[model samples]
Target: MKIRTRLSLLFTLITAIILLLFATAIYYSAAKDREKEFYSLLKKEAYTKANLFFDADITQKTLQDIYKNNRKILNEVEVAIYDTRSNLLYHDAVDIDMVKETPEMLQSIHEKGEISFYQGDWQVIGVRYPFQNEYYLITATAYDEYGYTKLNNLLNSSILIFILAILVIFFTGIYFSKKTFDPVRDMIKKAKIISASRLDLRLPLKDNKDELAELTNTFNEMLTRLENSFEAQKLFVSNTSHELRTPLTRLLTELELSEKKQLTNDEYASLIHNLTTDVQQLIRLSNSLLDLARANYDRSKITFKTVRIDEILLDARHQVQKLNPQYKVNICFDMETEDDSDISIEGNEYLLQVAFANLFENGCKFSDNLQSQVVITNKEKKIQLTFSDSGIGISEKDLKKIFDPFFRGDNKYFTEGNGIGLSLTKKIIEIHNGSITAQSELNHGTTFIIELPI
Candidate 1:
């Protein structure tokens, strides 16, 4: 069943049970009150009859006449009086015995001041009266016809009201439940219409601060991330295509020219050399692209270990120098620390090395002295590293786009690079829960600062 229907049924069932129990209690209390009131009336009638029967001013005939006259007022009432010896003394109704009089019954009445009991549908009351040094037993019995009729009417009315209330509650529950989930229904409809092309669309927000509003906010945030990722993926593909086409087109053109011409051996050798250079450029671009893609992967899929940041930096410096022997890298500690963990961080060693290597290569390749200087500092549970070079620095406008993929600045002519290094470095650092920022002025060179939690 749908949630609305199920909630409605559950709500109705619970209310119905409570109403049933309450109605039953009210009915039971009313019945008990009626029985108690009727018994009191019977007891009063019996005592009055006894007083009239033993009165010194009234004769026996007159007492009988009074009872006969009051017979219609007390409906179906029977009264009897007996001496202590169990001998009948007076009886208002001689034709019908509403209650059976026994010696045990008289003895009970004498022991107790008064007693009340039931005989079939009749309510019976027994009283002990003292007159002229002798005690008499008086018993009265009557049926509460009016009270029973009223009780039956109340039970029927209660059942009718209970059924009506249950129906009203069932429908009311449905109405309220529908009202509550209307916003959710609208949200689902809006979400269905939001395709990849329409990522800018957002769910409507309500004024009240509720869970549904919070859910909408979370969904909008997720959509924002997805939209950014899609845009990045598109840009990456376009750049990769453009970068690969240049080298491939040059290789194809050179090969075609060599095939169409009758060249000297030296010309052929130079042509081959040129082709080799183009192929090597293609290989480097492909590798950078692969590294960038790898860096964008979820961190959970990457292997992480406790590796020293200082060790990774040293390794990166060595690798850069091995590739370009003219490049010089100097590494030094800003502050001495006895704790080994001060320079240690939890990260993927390979990715960290890749990021550091890019920074080192950029620093040396862009500097006029062909050198990079790295300073490491450990403070506040973080490892901070600065890579500074005295090179033709980036302009203010170009610095902002340094980490963008395929974004080469005005210094592009000063060095041969695919422009993927800084972008890939940024992704790798982010994956390791680190931050990288650059500060530079034209002619003053540039410095890249990185912080990683230890």
Candidate 2:
């Protein structure tokens, strides 16, 4: 069953039980009051009969006539009188088979003064009356027909009221349940219209600061992240295709030219050398692309530990020099503290090395096979590394796009790179909660600065 239906039914059931209890209490109280009133009337009649029977001047016929005239009657009323020896003295003018009083009951009434109880459907009351200095027993019995009818009517009315109350409670529960879940329904409806092509769409949020509003806010954040990821994937695919197409096109053109004409041994050798260069260039581009992809992995999935920043720098400088033996990378440390423990940070060692290696390679590559200087400084739990290169530097406009994938500067047309190294380095730094910035003057020099928290 739906939650609304279940809630409604539960509400109705609970209300019905309470109503039943209330009705029962009311009905029982009314019945008790009716019984009390009937007993009072029977006792009144018995008293009147006792007064007339004890009057010395009244004859038996006169007593009966006075009793017939002065006594107020009730339905199914019956009265009996007994002498001190338990002999029958007076009987009421009742046509029904009256309930008999036992000697044991009269003995109890004599001792207790008065007693009332039920004899089957008849209500019986026994009283001790003193007349002429002798004790007499007066007993009355009756079935309260009017009170029974009233009780029956009350029971029927209570059942009707109980049913009506349950119906009201059930519908009220349903109405409120629908109102409570209306926001969820709206969210589902709006979510159905949202797709990849419509990622800019957002769910409506109320200012009520309730749970539903919180859910809507969370969904909107998720949509924003998905849109950013989609845009990044599109840019990556476009740049990779463009960068791969260039080297492949060059190789195909050179091969086609050689096939169309015969050439001398030196010309053939030159063509072969050019072909080998193109292949090697393609290999370098592929490796750089792979590194860029690997850098995008979530940092949580990679192994992390405390590592010394100075060791990473030394290792990166060694690797860069190994690749390009003629390039000089000078490292210098500038610290105010003698303790090297302050220079340690938590990170994946391999990825941190890759970021530093990219920066060193960029400095050496841009400085025209000349020397590059790397200076490290420590300040307030942070490490700052600066790479200074003296070569053809970047233009002011191209500097802004330098960290973008496949974005080479306008002044570095002859540089041997696919321009993915700096972007990959920037991504790695960001994942480690660090920052990288650059300052350059065309044909003068370029310097890259990196700051990492220790």
Candidate 3:
């Protein structure tokens, strides 16, 4: 069953149970009041007969006259008088029904002094008086107290009415349930139509400030983000193919022209050298793409070998100095702990070297070769490598895109770059679970900062 249906049914069941209890209480209360009224009438009739006997004017003629005067109301009742010896004194026994004149009941009446009730096809309450040494039996007919057959019939009819009410309530509850849940169903249907293949489709939102409307808005926002990412991916692919193809086409054309024409040895050598440089740059581009793709997929497992932070920095500094002898390189080590500590991490060694190499290369490329410098700082849990140069600095906007694949910040310095070096470097650091950032002043200098966990 649906949730709303079950909720309605539960509500109805609770209401019905309460109603049934209330009906039973009311029925009994009405029955009790009716029974009291019947007994009151019987008592009143018994006292009247006692008054007649006390007045000593209860003659057969007077009794008959009094009975005729109240016959309309008293015909449904019975009046009887008896002696202490069980002998009837003044009673019209033939007028009473035979079913009500049972011998066992009569015996109890005699023993109990006054009859409270007399059983028959109809309900009656009886009372007795002991005035003037006489026994009196006064009974009044009552429908609420004794009419068992009629009571049973009324009960069956009431049960049928209750059952019919429940059925009506059940269908009404189901209808209300469906009506309430219709909007939610509509939202689900609309959501089914909006997917990656149909990003233009938007979910309909209502003006109401409810959770469903908020959900619709959130879904729309998610779809918008996915569409933007997909568009960026397409543009990236197109740009990358064009950039790589230009050099490849030029190399192929140059080799073909050289082969078809006679050329001097120096000319041929120059063509071969140019072709080799293009091939090497293409190979580097491919490798950088592979590295970036690997970063997108997974990082390497940590192999925590105890490494000296000072040694790593010194080695990087030496490598940079050898690459650019005209520039000055400075290394600083701040050892906050004793030796043999785990001043190392479980990481891919080769990836870390690539990151350091990128920082050094960026410094060389951007530095004016006079004040070019790289600083290495180390402590307990982290190492910070800074490379500062007095060359041209990056613009604020270009700083963010420098690490993007095939991104170029300098058109002049990029004469030898396929623009994948810094992208590969960032990917390598990320694989080592580290960070690299750039801070630069336009005219004075540029700085590259790297932080890696030990």
Candidate 4:
């Protein structure tokens, strides 16, 4: 079902339940009041008879007739007189069960010399009156026969009322639901229309500031992200095709010519090395791009454990030194203590080490023209690693694109990079709830700073 219909049904159901409770309370309350009034009337008449019955002159027939016929005109009430021996003295028409004064029944009698009792189908009110003579009077009225005959008729008529009320509430709910879901439905429909091809179109936003307004705002944000992702994917495909075509074309040309022309062993080795290097760079670029894509999704199973930041930094430094022995690579351990107690962090030790290594290696590659220096500082709240290079620094415009996937600087053609180094670094930092940034000046050095929460 549509959201509008479901919401309407929900609202209508809730309102109906509340109405049912209210109607039940009112119906029961009216029935009790009617029963109480009748019981009171019978009690008064019985007390009058006790005075006239003339226990002082029990031989009088006139008082007995008056007592027997008293309150007989009250069609809904049943009056009974009890003697001192707990026997039924006299009674008028009785429809429902007459309450008898057993020890349990007497225990329930109220302070007002009356008792009120209810079983689901019957409500009874009984009042007891005492006389100076050797007799007691009891009066009772059944709510079932009195008001409930008319009440049952009224309740049956309310069946029609219940149907009408439900119809009215259901229609009202549907009308409001339509009004509420109109703009949102429109936005969703528009969203379904747009894809990577039609990203320029945006959904309409309503003016109202209710929940629907917030919904439209959220939808707009989603569209913005989709548009950005679409653009990035397009750019990445274009860059990848362009980068891959160069090496493949060269490899093809070299192979074709080598078959046609005689070549020395050294020349053949040089060609093979160049081809291998290009292939390796392409593979690195592909892997980095995959990592970048994967990082955007949930990492719920990315388990973490206690890993020393200094060890991770040292590993990355040692690996970079092994790769480029030409440049001076220096790493110093400035830990407060070598014990795990003094320096510590919680993360996957392997991934954390890879991230540090990527940053350090990238610095070393860019600094192949000069000395490369790196420093890692472990603080109480977090760990900060700074990798500085003496090679060409990033220009003002290229600074922002440093972390963007496949973003290569204009002046760094001599250096080697797949352009996803900083991108992967940023994603790793984000996973650890950390941050990474780049600071560089032209002709001077570039320094990359990373901070990770402990």
The local distance difference test score of each candidate is 0.90, 0.84, 0.65, 0.69
lDDT of candidate 3 at residue 13, scale 0 to 100 = 98
Candidate 3: give the clashing pairs.
Answer: 303-346
Backbone atom clashes (below 3 Å) for every candidate: 0, 0, 1, 0
Worst 10 residues of 1 by lDDT: 56-65
lDDT of each residue in 350-419, candidate 1, tens digit only = 8888888898889888887998989999768888999899989999999999999999989989878889
- Tens digits of per-residue lDDT for model 2, 1-454: 9877898898889888888898999999998998899889889877876786776556666655554554456464567788767787876553443667678888888899999999887788888999868999999887887889999999999889888888888888899988987888898899999998998888998897988888899999999999888877888899889888988999999999999999899999999999998998899889888888888888787777899988998898898888788878888987656676778888878888888888787777777767888888986678888888888888899999999887887755657788788899999889889999999998888999988898
Q: Ten-residue segment with the worst summed lDDT in candidate 3? A: 138-147
Please say which candidate is ahead in lDDT: 2 or 4: 2
TM of each candidate vs. truth: 0.82, 0.67, 0.56, 0.75
Residue 154's lDDT in candidate 1: 100
Root-mean-square deviation of Cα positions for candidate 1 versus the true structure, in angstroms: 3.8
- Model 3: per-residue Cα lDDT over 99-193, one tens digit each: 34445555666667556654543455455556656565443343333444445666677678778887888788878878877777887798788
Q: Which stretches of candidate 1 lie over 4 Å from their true place?
A: 1-7, 42-141, 176-180, 261-272
Question: With candidate 1 superimposed using the best TM-score fit, by how many Å does residue 119's alpha carbon deviate from the native?
Answer: 5.4
Sliding window of 10 residues with minimal summed lDDT for model 2: 65-74
**lDDT, candidate 4, 1-454, per-residue tens:** 9988998899888988887777778778876676666556656655555554435455335554543465454344444555544565655432333554464454344235676666454445555665653335364544345566777776776667777898899999999888877777787788799887887787777787888778778877888888898898898788778777877788888888888998899989988997887788778767666766666556687778888777777776676677666656666554555567445777767667667777667666666464676676776667777778876778999998888877888755857676776787788888888888889998677888878886
Give the winner by TM-score.
Answer: 1
- Give the lowest summed-lDDT range of ten residues in model 4: 92-101
Q: List the residue pairs that clash in candidate 4.
A: none
